[model samples]
Target: MSSIKAIVDQKLILEKMEGKGGWTFARVPKTTANTGKSYGWKNLKGTVDGFKVECSLMPLNKEYWFMPVKAEIRKMVGKQAGDYIQVLLYAEIQELHTPEDFLLCLQDDPQAFEHYRKLPDDEKQKYIDWIFATVDEELQVQRMADAIDRLSRNEKLPKKVLSAGKPA
Candidate 1:
């Protein structure tokens, strides 16, 4: 139930329930610096700490809308083109809530108004959350079903392999 403080005016705040199991956000992979050698060695590393949930503002009809956006979930790992990643929804404000109502109030006369305007549009579409199911206790039930299917197929999998990996 930990919540991050965000500006209600300049950004939109949204939440997705981690349910009883909780969740982790992932970081996008970064390109490596050139070594200036003929051997082209590209670095490919995955980061667990890079994932985060953020609120962003999007311009709509001369106004702005706040939406919750998720970044860096493990489900997106090794995703290829045309592949789909699953996301789970938590919660959001149905109506506009002003900055004054934010738990962490906007700083007193916080920076120039233009600063807010210069902010980037990183908000995700509203419907994206509709596609993902919550990462809940039910995941164990689903895993058990998958394991049973694998076992029936005569695949020699180690016991509890499905639950060994990270949870989204």
Candidate 2:
């Protein structure tokens, strides 16, 4: 994947969306986009404030793009809006493999699969990551089952919960 590194010496502006206010982002300059086209820009993997991240750049007018400076990142770097920052970004690979057991469970439960399929990519990644965090096969199976139950009911998984088998 294509990558870029640059210092962000601009202030982070707060923008409003859907009645909620949020921090604005530094933009991906056109020069960055040119390198990313061969790799696709829908999602990028990189670091901000030295923390690893995978995010999609928000497309702007005239082929320009931007990425939000999330609060978690702000806290990690110990800097707020208006602070100069550094960023390193590369196009994230498009191929994401879902576990076979999880896929089978989803196939057997159409309602759960429907809800799972409708989730935003990041949310889906959360569930997938949680389920795979451990190496225990039995635990992974149990987690997949629990995930199916939650999705079937259109319930969001609690952040603190790992699975029916164990605590995070």
Candidate 3:
């Protein structure tokens, strides 16, 4: 069972859900639990007991909501199920901008464009971010080309890389 009350102003919510193992890392405090409305999703940022995080506030079942905290975060925080930890968050919203060069490259291949469009906004943003996360223009160009090629092949990265536990 998960229990949390991540208090943000009205727009962001903090609630608990019924996930069997989600709550052990931290519980949203009960003091700010009863925020009036429920929304499908909200981007959240900040710390859960001073461990930095970027996560989502989302609904799980019919009656409640939860934050799906990552295992790495749980390990870093050194908390477990049934443990109580402080929750602090800020509602986050960001606009993703897909570079024109990427779009044009996609447009050159109908299948690639379709696959790219099918990707979630966050995934697309991550790809864009990764492509630009460098000072070497040559590497950035290579990554961009690789991204388009992989999309054309209907995959985020090559199968060999994934099978080898390597990230593209």
Candidate 4:
């Protein structure tokens, strides 16, 4: 874990490389840049301008790391480009919190449970996060059952999990 202070003063400029769209980013404070590199995209929990955010730092180049200031963060912080945003970051080892319903469904199917156990940590995290993102009880149950069915049949999940209200 590392801590440092710096201001945010970059514009949300879009970049293009030979006509391909690029990311919108804010540079990591120079003092904290090295810390992000050392962590190599590990989970980070920190406060930016008093707003709590959890995300992985992206390497911008050899000299800096950056985090995308998405529309949600921008609105929450109420700061625009060039504002002096304060940040305090700490590296964290996040534990996967699979939803209980999802786990129960998997537990009932031995084949699914076996395949799920074989998934890499990061892949498993995606499934858990997908479940966590579901806000409705009924949809969560359906998705869990769908996931288990796919796993049991050795079928791949969709590239991304569909929202609760969306069909899979």
Best by TM-score: 2
Estimate, for each residue in 1-168, the C-alpha lDDT of model 3 and write its tens digit.
223444542322223346765342233333343343454665667776688888765665555446666668767877655555566776534455788877887898898899989887766866787777777777777877888888889877554543443346
Better of 1 and 4 by TM-score: 4
Give the per-residue lDDT of model 1 (tens digit) for 68-104.
2333343434432233333222223233222321212
Write model 2 residue lDDT over 1-168, tens digit each, in one string: 322443222333433234357545666655555432423345666777578877676666555566777777777777665666667766533445677778888989999999999886667877898888889988888888888999999988886684542533
Instruction: List residue ranges in candidate 4 displaced over 4 A.
Output: 1-57, 60-90, 160-167
Tens digits of per-residue lDDT, candidate 4, 40-129, equal 663566666778887667666765667766657767988755565666666544455666767888999999999998886666765676
Candidate 1 matches the true fold with a TM-score of 0.16
Clashing pairs in 2: none
* lDDT of residue 133 for candidate 2: 87
What TM-score number comes out for model 3?
0.46
List the lowest-lDDT window of 10 residues for candidate 1. 122-131
Compared with the true structure, all predictions reach lDDT values of: 0.27, 0.67, 0.63, 0.63
Candidate 3 error regions (>4 Å)? 1-90, 158-168
The clash number for model 4 is 1
Residue 62 error for model 3, in Å? 14
For model 2, what is the error of residue 15's alpha carbon versus the real structure, in angstroms, after optimal superposition? 18
Candidate 1 vs. truth: CA RMSD? 24.9
